[model samples]
Target: MSDLPVVVAARRTPIGTRSRAFAQVRAEQLAGPVLRATLADAGSATGRPLDVADVVLGNCMGPGGNPARVAALAAGLGVGVPGVTVDRQCGSGLAAVLDAVTAIRAGDDRPRLAGGVESASTAPTRSVDGVPYDRAPFAPAGWPDPDMVEAAEDLARADAITRERQDAHAARSHARARAARDAGRFDAEIVPVGGVLADDSVGRAEPLLPRLRPLFPGGTLTAGTATRISDGAAAVAVVPHRLRGGAAGLVVRGHAVVGCDPALPGIGAAPAVLAALDAAEVRTGDVAAVEIVEAFAAQSLAVLGRLGLADDDPRVCADGGALALGHPWGASGAVAMVRLFSRLVRAGAPAGTLGVAAASVGGGMGVAAVVEVVR
Candidate 1:
């Protein structure tokens, strides 16, 4: 417990719209540069050469062949540095960070880089024997296995989340994101990608959000309220607490991954957050900030309402979320952590300030982690 890990540096590529600037860029292409840039940032910020022992990344759709290892070499991390990848759908990136934290807690003191990348523009069309398919089922036989959009609708129905509420939340997301971008809050951590310096998806969607129709019949969610498919990559440098040195940092306190009803996957993040906070011996009120992936405005609202939090909870996504920034599938989870890093660590929040990063998976699972600002 005393040897918990801490993030020394974090960086991510500017998220690109689907089939736009990053259409030709592969997942490895987005990941490799961010990996190299994170290491460089750590070294330059800490004023010391940090040796990375492993590179662990999360990927949902990349040509199947250990993309982490490929990205490691591409980033010039060397053939000696070990690499591994995890797949948990949308939660993959945060899960990767949890795995690294676990490894370090078990006594591996070497520095490691963990995050995720997604290039939806470049993801290959999956097929079975030449028949095109959208996605594989999340549940087994006799289990409810609805596609993501359907699951979100189910969750909205179950939680009584209204279209008006969803639109309001999404509009708020965009407004906050645009304000943050305008203030240059994102510039410090966003690495240039495909010649773009800022996230291209963020805008003032409030005025137009309420006019958008539902994505599915009888559903409350709309394209304006749901996250956009995007291309981006994010990585963070983690080391043993004793070795941590940087601007200001976050210490890994606790983490949990829990399962829920696959038919209503959007609600998974709440249970995961409860489990993680319990594991860390902290209460919701204790956390100074929160980052729950906004897969859909309905899903996010469901989580907040179930947790007894308001949609406008100041602690959650104070600078906006996936609804505004766009969701790069695997990369969105790490992007949440990067947001928390920017607010609590880089911005120099008071000592002992607690923050959480959490996301729901496609397979009815949720990954949540707790961190403390080391002021």
Candidate 2:
């Protein structure tokens, strides 16, 4: 029996713009349905009832008292399964999945559920010393800590990414997402929530993109070129490869997490991807699919350039990304992995087809995983 972890099922809630369809939903509420659906899918694939050993979830700005435990209980997983929450900012979801992979590699063969959830609409306001603050500092004092928007603007200037290019990229993302949705390409992986069956943020933005003003003075980034604040959840079921029962799935190969200069946080994914590919003994040209979180068009373009990919590479985000689907912070990374699964395993890609999922985190860090289709 192969000891490697294999993802047999993946699902996500329809992403909603902040203060919109999911405004009344809590973090655990958003996560519960997807967890239940993922477990059922995994059970159907393996043709046996799974004794889930644990539940691992990631979150950013939700009311915290171990949300993962609450979600597991809410999903009716029984009281026997223990749960743990992970926080790596934007990389939380993928990191949680990697944690499960680590456990399976350590000889614990029990099935595990791992993913991330975020409720931007219902996130509690925080205070420090009686003064309210929007978010905690990403870096400690004496470090270059810039707001994400500001960092994107700085990266645009440094990389000489033109305004026209950013606008075009964002427009392309929206068009692709719209086309995919229309063709029902997203139906298989989405679990309807809050009466929303489809992502609300994908729209025709080309006309409005060029009309928007720069977010910062003398900067190229505009609201149209940046991902919207959103609420959503995504989860996947992982089990030992021996239990796959000849079913199609993603076999976990290698993963890496690395940090870069805080000032150029948007470029962090480049090194992490390189390291992950090296660990898997795969080359850049050999990957059949890639999904990198699209927090900002300029930031994504910069990372792709560093990785020696063209600005409009078809292999990357073939059906669009966060810029069109919306960014739910911690859940975005897991969403990327789910996208890779749908594009490869669900689409009938042959065995041994390689794919990559990655995200450039807010605090100068990157997380990436290499997976291959197997039967």
- For each candidate, how many residue pairs have backbone atoms clashing (under 3 Å)? 0, 0
lDDT of each: 0.87, 0.91
Candidate with top lDDT is 2
lDDT of 1 at 363: 78
lDDT (10s digit) by residue, model 1, range 48-110: 788898998999987868888889999998889989998999999998888888888888888
TM-score of 1: 0.97
- The deviation in Å at residue 37 for candidate 1 is 1.3
Query: Weakest 10 consecutive residues, lDDT, candidate 1?
Result: 240-249
Model 2, residue 339: distance off in Å is 0.5
- The worst-scoring run of ten residues by lDDT in candidate 2 lies at 240-249
TM-scores for every predicted model = 0.97, 0.99
Candidate 2 lDDT over residue span 1-375, tens digit each: 277889999999999999998999999899999999999999998898889999999899989999899999999999998899999988899999999988988999889999999999999999998999989998999999899999999999999999999998999899888888998989999999868899988984557998999988888999999999999999999998777776678987889999998888898888999999999999999999999999999999999999999988999999999999999997999999899989998999998999999989887999999999987
- Show model 2 residue runs off by greater than 4 Å: none
Residue 164 in candidate 1, Cα distance off native in Å: 0.5
